[model samples]
Target chain A: MRLSYPANVKIILVPCTGKVDVMHLLQAIQRGADGVYCVGCLEGTCHYNQGNLRCRERVERVREILQEIGLEPDRVRMYNLSSGEAPTFVAYAREMTELIRRLGPNPLKHSKPSIRLEEAA
Target chain B: MIVAKRKPFEEILQMIAGHRKVLIAGCGTCVAVCLAGGEKEVAVLAAEIDMARRLKNQPIELGQTTLERQCDREYLAQLDDRAASYEAIVSLACGVGIQFLAERFPTIPVYPGVDTCGLAVNQDVGWYEERCRSCGRCVLDRTGGICPVTLCAKGLYNGPCGGTNRGFCEIDPEQPCAWYAIYERLKGQGRLERIRAITPVQEWRDTVPRTLLQPGYRKPEKAKS
Candidate 1:
């Protein structure tokens, strides 16, 4: 089944979302990605039993880290859908793109006026 | 193994606030296993620090390295050539490793990235419960292999107190009463009589620096001058 999602959403495929590490999410934002979202298998239906569940925890951790560092936690998210749910997958992709659009660009992307950390503090 | 947790990023960011170049250090042994200051953690932290500093418009240059064990002089020597060059070093090891790193490179300011908690048992992924307190004495023989000092909220030596409600400690309803668990364990082992014997009060004195002299090691006397 052919379906289309936002062209702006660059996909990075993993064998299973469980392989997505916390650093992967953080690095994406650090390198100027406006947002990052992990789409794992439906909660209990993960083929690997707990792969998707593990991914969910890592996603939540990254979200908390983002929030703690003074950034919007909403920039990162976790969505679960089954293999048969192509329409749901497209919907999630579009929804993620829309959310990121509203959040504007990542704060790290554009440089602000030069100021010492002491002054910035 | 030693357990530790990363410090709040805001506090870590402030630790090297004035520094333009920094080295983020990590330990591979206990911290790595505990998911604190391992190689992956160093990379994640370096990325975070880089992004945080850049957002503030005072971007910092971050470098990182993870040693096998930061507590040992042999492993700390791996950073010998590079440790002295950084403006500040952020160590993600436990307190012992941090002190060792600081001692090795006295001129550079060493800041801790993680708080060392205690010896723990990994109950599950990302879940660690304290198992030992390093009280310098072992009394597991009397307590049926359970440490009363660590498991008992009151650190009582005799047995469970009035606060041992059912099988849980009163301090935290979720925590199991140490004495109750000990009793159950002894009963299972057919050594229930162990609980009846009075365990003498422990001596908590520390007259000399608590240093261990393992076999085949240099003595602490420094060759008697």
Candidate 2:
């Protein structure tokens, strides 16, 4: 059987994970993802010399924000994996799926009003 | 250019603690140039607040949006409708943007996420220093065009006072005395004689309680209708 991940976990494929801006990372959280992770080229191996570095910085910054917002910073994570790193990719997927599973369903799922209420309180 | 720095995220969070619905507004101008308040900043703030609320199970409705220029009413008009939805607004723009947001969203409380420091020019990437004070009355035509309001430390309009030492300022050893530089610059230009003319004290109103005006940006009567 082909290995698949949790149906609820949405994987976004970016050309280079380094291209992810801090806002985009935050936007993922705002859009109601249970957990978000990025897979990018290893340090110093990015297609763009420092794109991965920049993306890593963004991820780290988001982690700090998550903590301030009273969430576990672990909710958003970044990993360095070249295109050929299939095992690493699958491992990351599994890890994120497990984390999301523990986090349970997204608070905003199918309930905009309730999400807003929850957010307001 | 205005120089500013991001207030610590925690400080910002504390400022908007009571508001259930919040908007993070970024200025696309001066603060953006410094990488403090811009679209990226607004997004980061919104996300941080969201995550914080989620973790606490307190949940705060947060929105992210940016304006091209916070000082211009034309650009600020964009926030009109959305401003009503949020209980409070956090501005990442310079002091101007924060004030503009307040003016536009009078009913909704507006907060600043960055401290608007004095006017400055980038000394290098990620570095900036005080430059202009926009003192309304400009005297750059004389004194070799250097601004005294920001540079002189004393805002002196005359020759270097007794405090200057070896052409450096007493206030800061790294800074060359403003009048000393002005003297040298004007002497080289053969305009040193102009220093004898005392400039009237710069009016205080021009430099503070800052105001912004955008010509011809008001919606026409037809548009308003």
Candidate 3:
């Protein structure tokens, strides 16, 4: 389908949503992507059986870590839908983009270069 | 393996609140397998702390390194070249590893990021249950494979304290009575007679710090003096 989604919703294609690691989401927010979310195949219908489920777990893990770090957990999320639902995909994209706008920019939008602790000592 | 649990994130943040730079060291042995401290956990923590401090406007420069084992001097030597650069260290190792890191880096403040739980068995991912207390005594021959010292609420050596309710301990209804399990196991193995014999009262080890010297590692009697 030649449907349009928010252009700001930069897409990163993985072999499977299960391929997304916890670090990937954190790194995005740390590097100033105000928000990050994963769109995986609907539950129980992942291409690789449990890949999408695993993706959900990782997404939840990142969300929890965000809360623990005193950040908005909603900044990270996971959505599932069938491949044929292009409109739903667009809807989710718009929804997430709106959510991020409401949450404002990631506080870490401007990170100083990370240096070794020893260098500081 | 010695199991450990990570301390609260707020506690960790407080431990380094005054420091502008710190190192989070990880251990790759027991704590790693238990998922409390490992390469992945270290990176996740580092990222969390980085973002957290930034948000607080008290940004910190954090460094992370996962070693093969932090308890051994040889492995810790890997950080010798750069250990002096940090004002503080948050060790994501067991209590022993934390001590070892402290001993190795005496000048810098060393804080424990995890609480050493004790010996445990990994039943599954993110699940670890304590199984031993390392009391410096082994009595498995009489108690069957179930450890009375650990499983029992009172750490009884002989038998249950009569608080067992339907095979579960009265102290914790969910936990099966340690002695009851021992008796059932002994009965299955046709070794019920072992439970009948009273285990001699063990001498209290009042020594503050216990040291064990392997036969080959100990000095000869003549040289011991």
Candidate 4:
């Protein structure tokens, strides 16, 4: 299983993708992550039953929240893959990296000047 | 529980627009259970609003607090002095809590952050279905614990209306007709005869803004004897 994906793509493993709360994705974005994506077991094939399904719902909800706040909803996503599908995982990583590259850095990271001025005022 | 939903983000922003500082008051009881105005939701909303405002160059001074039960005067009193610092308060409580806050804080303008839906039962995670309308009359005994007032689209007491087709509601094909459910439940309990007993016209007087003085509390004038 020696697969080469984007070196810049960092991964944070979770017990189950269902354990991925909305706050986790949001905090990642707030902490200057250009993009965040959850890779869970394939739909209906979750080890803890509907863990992947629940993660999908949470991703959609976070997407909606992002859209409401004028952020690029595409910056976050949920992907399904089984343990054997290493190729698919690499493909998803590449796809997400490309999407984020096109979208540029998260606006929050660049908007510090106005925020600093606001605090100073 | 009294279910509620957050008002649209845009609408909420509009409410506190001109104000530079505001407090988000969350209710920890019913609205929390409904996932609308709990402590976690308050934090999420605060972060969202803060981010949105910062993006627009109109950063707001936002504070957050959650009351054990917003409807109770004692719980609301906790914010007595602290709430004075903010220009306005955005209450993430049900309608009752919003009104209660206004009453308790006569000088402060308290805005509603959530819309009180109705009495609801959790259908599943993130899904709630209205179960009762609090119509002031209990008909669960006759309806076999199925509430037609809230479940039926038309709120018909003597029902299984003409719109019912093969036990499904005409309004939504996916939903079972409330009266059909009532009939099945009664049949299962061997209480089908209860449905036949003509229910009198519901007293509309009780439906108005009514208050019940708890028996142990101050007795009403009529009950003074």
> Which is the leading candidate under TM-score?
3
Which runs of model 2 end up more than 4 angstroms from their true locations? Answer: A1-18, A24-60, A63-67, A70-121, B123-125, B203-225
Top candidate, metric DockQ: 3
Across B1-225, the per-residue lDDT of candidate 4 in tens digits comes to: 999999999999999999888888888999999899998898778878777887787878888888999888778878876778888889999999999898888788999999999999999877998999998888899999999889999998898889998999999899989999999999999999988977787877666677877768875568321
Sequence-dependent TM-score of model 3:
0.94
Clashes in predicted model 2: 4
Query: Per-residue lDDT of B61-167 in model 2, one digit per residue for the tens?
Result: 77777788887877887766556877888888888778877987788888889999978888887799887877767888887988877799888877689999899
Docking class of 4: incorrect
Between candidates 2 and 3, the one scoring higher on DockQ is: 3
Alpha carbon deviation, residue B119, candidate 1 (Å)? 0.9
Residue pairs in candidate 3 whose N, alpha carbon or C atoms collide under 3 angstroms: A118-B85
What is the TM-score of each candidate's chain B when compared with the real chain B? 0.94, 0.86, 0.94, 0.94
Clashing pairs in model 2, backbone N/Cα/C closer than 3 A: A69-B52, A70-B52, A119-B59, A119-B60
Steric clash count of candidate 4: 0
Reference-based TM-score of each model: 0.89, 0.69, 0.94, 0.85
Displacement of residue B84 (Cα, Å) in model 1 is: 1.5
Residue A74 alpha-carbon offset, candidate 4, angstroms: 1.7
Tell me the whole-model lDDT of each prediction, alpha carbons only. 0.86, 0.76, 0.88, 0.86
Order the numbered candidates by DockQ, best leading: 3, 1, 4, 2
Fraction of native contacts (fnat) of each candidate = 0.31, 0.35, 0.56, 0.17
- Give the per-residue lDDT of model 3 (tens digit) for B153-203: 988888888798889999887989999999999999999999998887656
Candidate 3 chain B lowest-lDDT run of ten: B216-225
